[model samples]
Each structure stands twice: as C-alpha cells, then as structure tokens.
Target: MGCAHGKCCNRDSSTSDEHSGHHQRGIRPYKNKDGLTQRSLELVHVPSHNFTLQYSSLTQHGYYPDTTDRENQDSFCIKTQIQGNPNVHFFGVFDGHGQYGAHCSNFVKDKLVEILSSDPTLLDDPLKAYNSAFLATNSELRDSEIDDALSGTTAITVLVVGDTLYVANVGDSRAVIAVKDGDRILAEDLSVDQTPFRKDEYDRVKLFGARVLSVDQVEGLKDPDIQHWGDEESHGGDPPRLWVPNGMYPGTAFTRSVGDSTAEKIGVIAVPEISIVRLTPSHLFFVVASDGVFEFLSSQTVVNMATAKVSYTLDFNACLLQNNATAYKDPSDACTAIAGDSYKRWLELENRTDDITIIIVQIKGLSNQSVVGTTDSEVHSRPCQTGGSMNQSAAIVPPLMHQKPLESVGHSSCSFLSLYIYIYLSHLFFIHCATRLVDLPYTWFLCFATCVIFFIVVPAYIQPLGEESSYYLCFLMIFFSK
Candidate 1:
C-alpha cells in the first residue's frame, strides 16, 4: 500500500540464472526494507488462460474452542470474467475462534468483497484499501472495547480478473497457486504467510526482548523434566509454534494481523507484506486454503486430485472423488466431475486446531463457463486411478494474441480519474474514522453513507457531465457536431 518505492525493483541484485526466479517482468522479488527472500515469491500462467472454476469448504471444532481463546479462520475467493462482464465474483473464509465452529459460521458473510468497484480507486489500489480496512477494524475494536483479550480470525482472499488473479492476506491463512511448467511449481504468491518465520518478526521479539518458537519448539519448551530430550521420543519432531511473542519464544511469530491491538502494543501483531501475482495464462489451478487442509495433506497432493479429469460438474460436492483412495472420473460423466476434490473436507469433527476452507481453480478451460447443466450432470463415475498427475489439458499459459490491451493509463487519464477521486474521498472519510478524529456512532453512519455514494453515484459523473440541458440547444449542438 505504500507508494512505489522502487525497492521491489532490485535490478542490481537480480539473479537471472535459469535456476533463479528473477527477471519476472516489472516484478522481481521484493525484499522488505529488511532485505530477505522469505518474502520473495512468484506467479505464473500455463498453456492458455481458458479453464473451469470450482470450489468447496468445510470446518469442524477439533479439540475445543467453543469455550477457549484459540481461534481459526480459512477462506478463499474465485472471480471469473467468463461472463465477460465488468463485475467480479469474490469470496472469502472468515474462520473464527478456534474453540468451536462459531468463528467461521458467519465469517463468509462478513468477509465479502465490499462492492468497492463503485469506487474505481479502491479497486485500483486494493493494497491501500486492504491495509486501511485492517487498521480501521483494529481501531474500531480497540475504541469500542469490543476486542478485549480474545477473539480473532485468519483470512485468505482471492480475486480473479479476466485471467489475472490477486491475493491479499493477514495472519496465517495461505494462498498457493500451481504452476504449469511440465508439472513444476509456478505459484507467484500474492500473500506471504504471516508466520513468525520471518527474521523481522524474530527481531521484533528481540526488540521487546520476547521469546519465540516454531510449532515444534513449543512442545520442546514443555516437559522440563525431560532433560536434554533431543527428539529421541518424538516421532515427527515438533509442530511449528503458532505464536512467538509476549515473553515466550525469543525468535519468531506474528508479523501482522487484526483484533490483536493488545498484541501489537506488545509487538506480537504485524502488518503483513502484500504480494501480487497476475494469474496469467501460464498459471494452472490456484489453491487458496486454510492450514487445516494443509495439516491433512500436502499442497501438491491436493493439486494432483484437483487437476485429475472427472465426470461431474467441478462445482459440486457429491461428485468429488474423495480418496476413493484416488480414482479418475468415468468417461461419460467427465463433464460432471467436481472441479476439485478434498479428502480433508471440514465436515469431519475430528479434533484439531483450526477451520478448513479452500478455493480450487482449474486452468485451460477456466476462462469461460457456458452452463454445462442437465445433460450428464448427474453422472459422477470416478476415474480408475489415484495418480496425482497434472492433466496436460489443464495447464495454463498467458497468450500474446490477447494481451491486456495497451492504454494510456495515468492519473489525468479519464480511465483513472474517477477511481482516484473515489479513493481520495473514501480514504478521507475512513482516515477520520480510523484516527477517531470524528469518532461516534452517528459519525459511523455518516461514513457508511459516504462510502455508498462514492461507489454508486461516481460513475454517472464520470460520463459526460456539465453538458447543457436544453432540447433545442442540445439538438442544434448535436446537429452541428455531427
């Protein structure tokens, strides 16, 4: 959200070896002012942009949270311009308090795209809007005393425009896009997992002189009785610690997030570094999911299942090829195969740590959907294979034939004018709310109303305003101009 600092463009430090991930357009790996590749990630498209889209989500209270402070949230969004319209279909998962399933139940509703397209500027500078939204929520919670010592959720949100998709995130929720390079990794990550894994997070702890721990370290810290207990009895070692602040582990945890105002003061909460990856033609399916799902399966494992051809509509759950121990769709029912399947679906009440949600997108045929319903829609005969291999047809690649048409896009340009105006006004109103400069319930109402007008009415002014309103005069001018 910060103005372009010309820092992400580390040309002098770029490494272009075929083995390196440098030289990716105007986008090279952006090291935070901290100088680290932990934030460096990439996005790629495969074959061509055409592809089919589908998604499913599930959640359960693993061990307990219906009464505890632990919270979890998992969400993902898929927007396809297949309808070839300006509107975008956005979705998100708002996993809440890890104690029970209560957190994520209504989160999806609260987590929708704020319909800001009405304000082109918000849409254009989504990063700023995103940061504003996060900080704004934190401010509100702190002011209202709504967030005391508990309650927060992790979020994973995705946006797809034409073939370009974007991800913005906070907390531990994650976004992983599959690349189509002969079954290789092509994910240009848009959201850095706000794990305590980064060095800055570690330094921040050191700043407060707090302790840190990966999930594994947490277990080790326990059971002081076991002197020098160096992984002798542990099977998989230790799980990564979810947190590393507040006088705990001294290394890493929590770089940025929401509802953690107290934690921020204590230096546990962090403002996430944003990552933007264009879901071009070369990119294949994208997996925007929660850690719950990851706990049950590896990312590539899910990709293998999702990309396998199926016989049911990729959007439905009944047709999903659950571990049927791994199988393919029947030839005739191929059209009805679920776009992606999940063995780790959230419906199971198995005790654990968090909620599970995932948005799976298939490439190649993803660009447009023409309502393939009714005929053979009920058929879901699983294919006869468990091989998690990429379907050659599902690979995506950005095409030169239909590039993002060139345009003179600038602040003064008509295309950008309306957007920035909307941004300025919306930003002004929120800045007031965020800073509590005019804080009040009444003021809240006013701010909300202003946001509505900016998105809904601004477009009209953008089109031919200031024209004289006279029947005869207008007709004469039109005639003369013609």
Candidate 2:
C-alpha cells in the first residue's frame, strides 16, 4: 500500500516503533516531497470522536504489476470530525489507471481533503467546493511531474454534514446507500457511473472531437469489407472505450476522470456530477467502493452484504420513533467482510483481478454500545416471511415473471422494482392524507365512508368466499392495510 506524501499516521507511538521493522524490511512509506505536501498512510485507523461512527476500509493489489512495481493503483481515506466540525465527515475511494496511476491516486488522496478542509467556501456551498477541489487537484497534477498524460484516477467522494449527504464522482467508482423500507432494506445509487456507455458522456466526448470506439471497430478500419457490427461489439465483446483520433494513447474505459491531461485534449474532463440527498430515519448505511467491486457485483448485492454483516442490528421501533441511535449500527464488521468477499470474488475470475477497495459508512444508525441482559422477546417474536407463502390478509400480487436467479441476469438489475413500488405506495398514501383528508372540507367524511366500505364492509362481505375469491380479497386488503 502507498501512503499520501509517503507517510502514515500511527495513532500509537508503540505501533510506530513496531512498524519500524517493516520499514527496514523494504515496506516503508516513501519520502516523496514532490507535488502534494500533505502526508497520509495506507491502512490508517481513524475513529470518530463526536458521533458514534464505526467504519472499516481495506485495499488489495491487482493481479498484474505495473511500471510502478505495484499491482494496485487504488487509494482511499476516511476522516471524521472535519476541522472540529462534528457533523462533517468525509469518505473517498480513488481508482487509478495507466502507468503512474498509483502516484496519481495517492496524490489526490492526500491533497484533495487538505484543500477542501482549508477552504472556507466548502461550508457555504459544498457542491462548488467539490467541483473546485477536483479541478484544483487535476490542475496541480498537470503541473506536477507525476505524468498526468500517462496516469489518472477515478474519484468518488462522500461528504456527510449533519443530515445532508453530498456525493461527487468523476469516474466509475460508485457510492450507494442502503435504506430501510419496512420489512426489507433497499439500495439507492448516489453516484452515476461515467462510462462511455452513458449517453451524456458519449455526447460530451463527441463534441470534443473524440471517437468512442471498440478495439474491433479500430480493427474494422483495416478491413473495409466488414458490413455491420453489433452496438457493443468489441475485442471479444469488450466494452466500447474512449480514444483520441489518430492516436492509440489513453484508451480509457470511463469518460470523466481526474489528472488525465492527455485525455483532456480529447474531451475527458474532470467535472463531477454532484448528488445530494438528506439522511432520514429510514436511511441505513452506504458503501463507497472502487470499480473493482462493482464490476463483479451490483449495488444491491453490496448493500445486502453490508447490511447483513454490519455489527449493529436495525431496530424497527427505533426507526419509527426517529431514534436513529437505537437503529444505528457500526459498519466495521461489514467493511471487513465486504473486503474479504470482494477479493474472493475477484480471485474467482480466471484472467486477472483489479485493485479492490471498499469503505462502509453507517448513516442514521449509531454503533451498538453493548448487548445488555437478555434479548427482547418482543423484538424477536415477529414471524419472518417465508419464501413459499404470503400472508392471507395481504394482497396476493404474483411474483415476478422471471424465476431465474440474480446470477442469471449478471446482477445488473438488483430487483429495484420492489423498492420503487414501496416508494410509490408510500408517496400515494402521504399525498392522499395531506391533500385530500386534511385540506378538503367535508371530504373527510366521504373518504371515511369509502374506506369503511372498502376495508370493513367489503372484507365482511367476502370472508366466507374462501380460496375462490382470494384475488378479490387481496384487492380489498390493499386498501384496508393502507
């Protein structure tokens, strides 16, 4: 692992002394004073002082070695209590590609935070700050001797300020949130993947006179007789890649990235799409990872794994009461498990593995202090839903048409339809209560009469119909439950 500015911060003096042996054994942080002056070390354990935050992060080397003598070209950083701002927290994962990518990622990891923290504007307009920081970092890299023409990194960063979360990304690295929705946990992508496949990216690069082509398309230029090609056809069906016309240099898969001066001439810019969402009681946890993990797994898979492996349990009543502390859970266990699983999955591939990095951040839930006394029977007494059965009182909506497993679909669609339905129904219920029942005069009585007929009277009228009338019963149950 490479450190920012070639220095790691050790919390314990004894640990620093212990690591001196490793330094002697040729595994020490470098003393690179060029470019960024700020220092950062890999695998530094940073705990929170203000909030109950438990997080874990890890990085692994890739299967193929680069000119830098290291296979991994990824870097990450976690900082809590930002400049004494207890509500402010930061998490970042940078995935580097090209020859000098390691140095590029490390440089950004060290300097970007320093620039954001020192600048006063970040507090007023976070989006502007994020944008400026990216441009500044890229500008610095261009002036530095790190060879931005041959090296660049994808940046995905999350800034949590009180209840607001601002995610900014300029590359394929992703940030996703796991939200609690009634009986199930839902996953929401906070950052957009800026690959050549995205229409906006493709258009932007085309405007800059760049050609998005596959290796097969470039090869087809040699054989004009080739009649037609599939949309995504490439070298063995590889994804279409960005390239500069008349040059075979900087064949990057992603459209937006930092410190790629060579690609910039051909329209690869570092502008990030900033995503903002408020942290609510329903918000569970979020994960920030490099493309290595996402290449093999979907966002929902990452969310499910993180939610299950998290050390804290989700408290239903606590969430309803808006007592996030009770629902809060630490993510150290989750992060560790995800890192191991990510590496394992990568190893399962036959050819090679990319650099794997994962950072799991707990959102609304605080870490569990300790288990006290016996487990609550009331909490554990609820019957879990079985795979084969649906509650008779509930609607009998048929299952999805496709019975194939998630693996069959390559995990592209992680069953987000269920999440969409839950959101849509909740929104409808709220809209009815707010616009119809509360504001309309005398309409409340009409609505009540309708509810009574649909829920109470209709159910009584159909109870004796038995299995033959299940479809109608389910229809009645939908309104009744609402």
Candidate 3:
C-alpha cells in the first residue's frame, strides 16, 4: 500500500467576534496527495442493494477564555465508495489536544482513511485491516513534521461494508447506535472509553511506569497513592490522569491516543478497540462524536435528543399507509441540535467548552429485507447490543434537553392556528383564479390542481420547511377545498 502524507497549511489566528455562533475559523479545506479535498463536513447519499445511508456532521469551537485565540481542534472525515465499492462507507471524528493539536488531528484524519481505502484486503478481513490501518496511521503521524511530543488526538470511526458496521475507537471519543425496540428507541454504546477509570487499562498503564493521579493529587492537594476515583459518571472528584513517574509533564487524561510521544512511553497506545455490529431493521441510526458531546450527556440522553427531532410511528398500519417511509428527521438538523446542546452544557458547567463535533447517520430501506453479517454471538460478545432492555425505565429528562417538535398542525397549536388562517386565505385566491379561468360550475379543476400542489409539491418541500409541515399543510388543504 502507498502511504502518501499531507501537509498542514497555516491558519489565521484571529478569533471570531460572535462567541455564540458556530466557530468557522477552525474549518479549513485539506487536500491530500490524491488531490481530493476534505472539509469539515460533507453531505452525501450512499445507496446499497439493501439500504441507503444518509449522513450529516457539525463542529463547534469551544469557549477558551483563558487562551489567546486558538483554532478549533476538532476534525472529521466522510468518504464514500471506499476502494471503489459502493456498498462501503466511512465516517470519523477526531478530537485533538495539546499545543499542536489541530495539525496532528488534520493529518491523522486525512491519512488514516486514505490508508484504509487503499488497502486491498479491507473487504475480506475488516478486523485485520482496521488494526493495520490504525498502527500505520500512528507511525505516519509520528514521522510527519508536526511536533507531537505532547500533543495528540482521540479518534472514533465507523466503517460500513454492506450490512455490517465496524467501529474503531481510541481515547475518549465515542460511537453509539439507536435500536428500535417495539415502540421505544434506545441507545447502545459501540465503544467503551479508554481511560484510567477502566481497571484493566489502569493496571496495564501502571505496569508500564505510569503514575495515575488527578490534578489535585499532582499538585499536593490530595494523596497520590490512593486510587479513589469511580467510573466516568459519578466520579464526583477530579478525574485521574496519567503522568510520568518523576515529573508532572505530559499529563493526559486518556489511556490511549495517537502521536503523544511523551505519554507513549507510559503505555498510552494508538491501538483501537474495534466492535462489529450487523445492521438490522431494528437499528435505526448511529452517532459518532467527540468526548465534547458526551461529557455531560448520557448515552441515553443523546439518543433521545436525536430521535426527538424525527417523528416515527410504531403502528404498522401507519407505516403501510405511508409506504414504509423512513427518516422522518433530517440528519443535519439532528447534528445541529446535538452540537448546540453540548456547547450550552459546557458553558453552564465550566465556563469553557471543548471542541464539539458530531456525525449522525440514519439507516433506511432495511425494513423490508433481511440483513446479513456476523452472528449474534459475535456481536453480543462486545459492547454492541440494543439499549432498550437496559434503559427501559430510565428517568425522563426535562423538556429543555429535548428537541422541540417541528412546527405543524397537531404538533404545535400556535403554529397550527396560524397555518389554518393562511390556508383559508390561499383557498380564496385559488377560487378566484378558478372563476377567472372557467365557469363557476366547473370549479372542480381548481380543486384537483390544489390537490396536486398539496400532495406532490408540498411534500417535496417538507425537508426545507421542517419534516412535519407537509402533513399539516395537506390536512388544511383538504378542509378548505371542501
């Protein structure tokens, strides 16, 4: 395989005046050796024999009040037709940290996927291919001109081949899937975070001479010998970090990452934890995001927020009436909601936020066909499984955490009344046009034309107007035409 490296360009140092707006300074177009340009996000449609994949991504710069204007360290990649195969797709999110974090992230983001796409054996043995690609990409990053002695990135990626999904993760970034269980949708974790909180990871790093201690412990504010931190959640005190035994330099919170040369000596590795999941009709969508989004939000909470934007009915008759239409929520809207909510949560807690990036992929067209891939035993052996049974009785969250319903009749009463009045006026104008075009007795032609507009033209505009707007428009059109 040919490994072609890409160089990072100089970025502007100026910060945006609007602190609340989406951070645009960190988004720059990167061109690899193949002359292919990679941007922050790309909107694409991948069609397969059994299902179609639709994806959207969003990134926001964090609020760093203490630093002198820094660029966004979050980077993402979306590639379709991997190795010229239409059934294969790739998506990734990288969260960089340290002084030269941005350059490290962008380099790895471009080269990692490129290496996997160029591999010949990727299709036959995805597990081996994933391991080789990650190790090779780490070596390439270390050889690059970027100074990564103390800086590195966390990567969470997903590769789709036909009906199977291979998720590879390092560091703290995470991937999650939404499984439809009867009437409720639930979130299942695709990757477990590699941090000191995991007992196995902590023991391995300690065996390699790493001293795990929180900032407070390192500063002599607490005892370093005592290991008292609990799991990621409910770890009420300062989180444990890995540092050199003798010095306080190169303290990293994650147990695994790419290009952290100083921390690598203490067992922080670039190897990824790969999970294989077979796509079924019950699998609705999946989210790949940086730790920024999952910092304060639970996996279940994130799934609920993503699904709230999409209105899905569990009734078989309703689905049959609509011809089994899938994807009620646009993926882009879901990305925006996740990013925005994460940004807000960061500001609320620490007054500063981490770079937030999110990618949402919705699975469609699998309802009518049987999905083929790995056996159930292989999938359940890892952290991949439906979350409904686990979180069935999860407590309800406040309305603020959920996405507001799309404005339409029967969904938002205020909007419904306003739309009803607007349609009544439009009906009068159409009746007048009918009278001018033909006799009053032959006005049924106008009603037919109105039906065409409401049924055909309006549905096409539903995405732009909001997904639920079409139903309400059709409802009002029928009432006024009568």
lDDT of 1: 0.37
- TM-score: which candidate is best? 3
| Segments in model 1 whose C-alpha atoms lie over 4 Å from true places | 1-52, 60-87, 98-112, 115-120, 143-145, 183-190, 214-253, 309-353, 364-482
Q: What is the C-alpha RMSD of each candidate to the true structure, in Å?
A: 24.0, 18.2, 19.0
Question: In candidate 3, which residue pairs get closer than 3 Å at backbone N, Cα or C atoms, i.e. clash?
Answer: none
lDDT of 1 by residue, 1-482 (tens): 00011111001111111112112223322211211111111122221233344433333222232424332222233332212223233434443332111222222223233332323445345556555555554454345423323334455666554344546576655666655543233333445556435555546544854444333344455652332323211223232233324433222223455544434554645354555554444455566655555544444455444445323334322122333322222211211122212222333423333334454444445444222212222223121110000002232333223333111112222335444444555455455554563656677777677566645564355433422222233343344433
Candidate 2, 353-439: lDDT as tens digits: 566777776643433321112222222111111000010111112222352110111222213443344345444544555465676
Q: Which residue pairs show backbone clashes in model 2?
A: 328-365, 328-366
Each candidate structure's count of clashing pairs: 74, 2, 0
Q: By the lDDT metric, which is better: model 1 or model 2?
A: 2
Q: What's model 3's lDDT at 158?
A: 92
Candidate models: Cα lDDT each: 0.37, 0.57, 0.66
lDDT, candidate 3, 1-482, per-residue tens: 00001111122111111211122323442211111111223333333334777777776666656642555666777777676555677888877776556666766777788789778777567778899999998998887766677777889999876666888998999998887755567778888999899999999999999988877788888888889787797665367888888987677878999888889999999999988776777788889988889988778667767775344345311111123333336877778777888888878877567667788898877754433332223111111111000102221112221422111112322245444554565567467556665766657876678656744575455534643564566556557556
TM-score of 3: 0.66
